[model samples]
Target: MGLGLGFELLKTEGAARRGRLTTAHGAVETPAFMPVGTVGTVKGMLPGSVRETGAQILLGNTYHLMLRPTAERVAQFGGLHRFMNWNGPILTDSGGFQVMSLSDLRTLDEDGVTFKSHLDGRRHRLTPERSMRIQHLLDSNVTMCLDECTPFPATHEVAEKSMRLSMRWARRSRDAFVERPGYGLFGIVQGGVYPDLRAESVEALTGIGFDGYAVGGLAVGEGQQMMFDVLDFTTPLMPADRPRYLMGVGRPSDLIGAVRRGIDMFDCVMPTRSGRTGQAFVRRGVLNMRNARHAHDTRPLDEECRCPACRDYTRGYLHHLFRAGEMLGPMLLTWHNLTYYQDLMAELRRAIEEGCFERRAAELEAGLALGDLPAVPDPLAGPVAAPPVPEESSSVPVDL
Candidate 1:
């Protein structure tokens, strides 16, 4: 009884697509970026502010919600929209990734995975049917299937074995999902970095069918070039009639590359997470607010950004807040980063519509290539300051 999730492909440029997704809650422009709102809230941000940043949808984690307040608790409060004060569309993952990555003692099998909760160590079981039911309880507008996210660097034998297991789970998830108007299920394609396995995964998901298809098992350990390589070959085979998503991806450049490769939807915690750690995503790339050089600087993070942090504050002031360990620092920066991401998406959509995606993308990327603005010369040129710590490596998993 499942139906298409009301996706309308309005335009295309090369491999890029411009479209819209209509859900029970609202409509999201394609090439859209969904900010991760794990545990029912986007950390350091209010729903009103997130909306102001131009986000039409938020991605929730089924594993986190199922553990904490629980899906039943959310349903009691009239679903995630009402519960979180976000009236827009919501997408929830199947809890498989978290079970595999976060949980301590995880056991995988055909029926599902059994593991202890990362938060409490309480035993729990997650099958395809249970995952579907949890998303239903949360009233998710877009529900992801319970697929095993295969780890990177595995042998072909290992990758194929994992992918095949996920394909079998996809069928179970498809059968278990209850079709509701304006709400739909998406199947994840998992094959590590293998092209043949990816082709097989695409075939498996499309054959069983879904409202949309998501390329998963990427951004795990594969570098950016490898990720692009996977998309280059794999995206062409995906059903264009349905929306195509790239799950758990990525930086601004990554988003740009993916959009250029024809992915319509994406979700990631990079922006918000960086915001908390004193990193600001600006037009000229990431600027560190924790640096001492900014202590006396008075310029805004990005002159082009309209976020309050930029419009109303200064780099010196932002630096002061972070140095003082004020909570407002993270909030203001999170708002700014989200606003930047939305602005990027809007520009990409506009570019695709205007048939100038290549030029626009080139310009945007070249801006980042220019790197952060040159440091202003120190007034006194006094004793040298501490060397800035390198931005944390992405390999280490951080909570969304």
Candidate 2:
């Protein structure tokens, strides 16, 4: 392998591809979904449970980690992997996104962005050099370069200016990165929605060189079609041998679409976030537990699913827990959602290997549109008893 982040294309069907990426922790299957562990944890799920969901890598936020445990502390404790007790690879953002998104107030310059922290209103500075330093201290397997995440709905001029500034920062980030075996620095390509600017951004970053490339700035409120259009042109311009990561994107359909456009990696908060809100993802489609229609439903979220949420609980139980604001609601749903995503990734990899990705993609899209199970019988409206739980399974509630 070239380093911690290296791509090897195994199969291809048109623009779609099947590949493997090597990292210090292990090899991650291509077109994989990396769960967002913003603060060294993937929300409600434990690190072991997260691995059970087939996640080979997890993302950590430089802004949050730096503020909370502080990079120095994390380093002292033996980096993010040992600190979090997770053996899998971890990718740390450049602290640029959080600075732009979470910083209460901020100003940008050639040096970096100066902002007030959202946590305690403490002032801080984040530049390419500082970002590299933080991720290095964390000993992140993959580190992102510090770059301005252009504001949403920007005009052509505004986007261009921001894109150019981020390009300059990319060079500085590369220069500051420590050259070590099995460590990588990724340069983000930002151009908002302009194709020309995106091309220019790519050229600049490629000239500077990086271990990998990420397509940033698309998932910031732009519609799906626009995002796809940007990926259509942008992904091809990136080095084919290196990994192409679509950062902070997206829903299940988005993953499928991006993979169809030749993307090799992805990370997002949709599955975990939706799970916390009592939403379970199934092959058929998304199911919401908040709806009154499932008050006495006996069916599982997906009859075909073999996950804990679907195996041990009925729609009624999940519905009741969600309505009661129970922690189990988030836990079970998060688990199910993650399981579903992992299964989907496995299916995609299989299809790509079988040389039938296009056909499989069509089947998946059509299946998800078929919708959910019918509403259950109401006990008040009719004499119906609650469904019995399986004998071997315990329904004990615990906080995630």
Candidate 3:
């Protein structure tokens, strides 16, 4: 039976851990990967398909959902879960990231941000209280506090000022989130790679008290090593019992590193976004299906996988679908990529439970280094050279 929302750390292998997050809809095993479904839908994916990929939770964006469908409309129909037909947990992000990224038509003030919509140039404002109210109306199982994503490469002084401002907003976000049983509110830690500021931010949020804590402000164009370094210093400062979420994070390598460093949850658009662009992620690496060499290949995208795309279609068919601009190509690849990510998470959880996470992590990293099957030449490129493959490329097999 699905338990109400609560996080339980089940096992640990070094700082790396595995856990169960019981939500009103279902039990999600962690460390977990939540496929980004901003605006209540993961593009090119049906909710049932997403569930079939092993995702027990999905992420919605307050900014987009509020702007388009309007939170009230979703609530009127039934909250986000019923509206989207996803019974599993739904985690909603505060509108802060979108407001910061969509900055051209926005004004920033101490209270929050005032912006013109990218959709239709309509005026709007987003403050901590407003953000909380929006998520509450959407009935998010897990809600994030509104905090600015301090831009990368910011000077120490600028970073400090932004961090402090976010801290104040965190308090407001905390005070505004409605307390209810079987729901959670998470505070985001922002310090822009500075250890001292990160510590201060974590301490401030801990003082404010939240159901969970997120390591924010990393993976915003900062390289992996730097992001990992910050996590190395910052995650330990977070309370051990609460779930540790890394927001807006990255590739397979980044997820592996974060899991090793104690992150319990992640949400990113890489896999889905990449899938739309003809990029396919497999256990071996990434492949671009638009390449011309696949025009004659009859093999599945990844022979060892069982996603619908791989189960029912050939590389030649996928290549033709993409070349012909059929929507099915993107849908198939997106499904495969999401399935791969969820499988990766489940494998990690099992590895931790079985006390072999170290070995599994090393193996995954080694496989990533081996690269993907060569992509066919892009027709637009005319006479493009073959993709480079290291001498040891053939060593890694597609296993997912």
Most accurate candidate by TM-score: 1
The true-versus-predicted C-alpha distance at residue 287 of model 3, in Å, is 0.4
Cα distance off (Å), candidate 3, residue 307 = 0.4
> lDDT of all predictions, in order shown?
0.93, 0.88, 0.90
Q: Per-residue CA lDDT of candidate 1, range 1-400, in tens?
A: 4574798999999999999999989899999999999999999988999999999999999999999899999999999999999999999999888888954589888899999887778989999999999999999999999989988888999999999999999999999998988999999998888999999999999899899999999999889999999999999999988899999999999999999999999999999999999999998989999999898887899999999999999998999999999999999999999999999999999999999999999999999888888788766667665555467843543332
lDDT for predicted candidate 1 compared with the true structure: 0.93
TM-score of 1: 0.94
Identify the candidate with maximal lDDT. 1
Q: Model 2 Cα displacement at 398 (Å)?
A: 48
Candidate 2, after superposition: displacement of residue 48 in Å?
0.9
**lDDT digits (tens) for residues 1-400 of candidate 2:** 1354666888888888888877778788887888889998998898999988888989999999988989999999999999998998888988898788863488888899998888888988888999999999998989999999987799999999999999999999988998776689999999999999999999999888888899999888988999999999898899887888999988888888898998877888888999999788888789888998888788888887777899999988999999999999999999888888888888888999999999999899888888886565676775445566578878753332
List the candidates ranked by TM-score, beginning with the highest. Answer: 1, 2, 3
TM-score to native of every candidate shown: 0.94, 0.93, 0.92
Which should have the higher TM-score, number 2 or number 3?
2
Worst 10 residues of 3 by lDDT: 376-385
lDDT of 1 at 73: 98
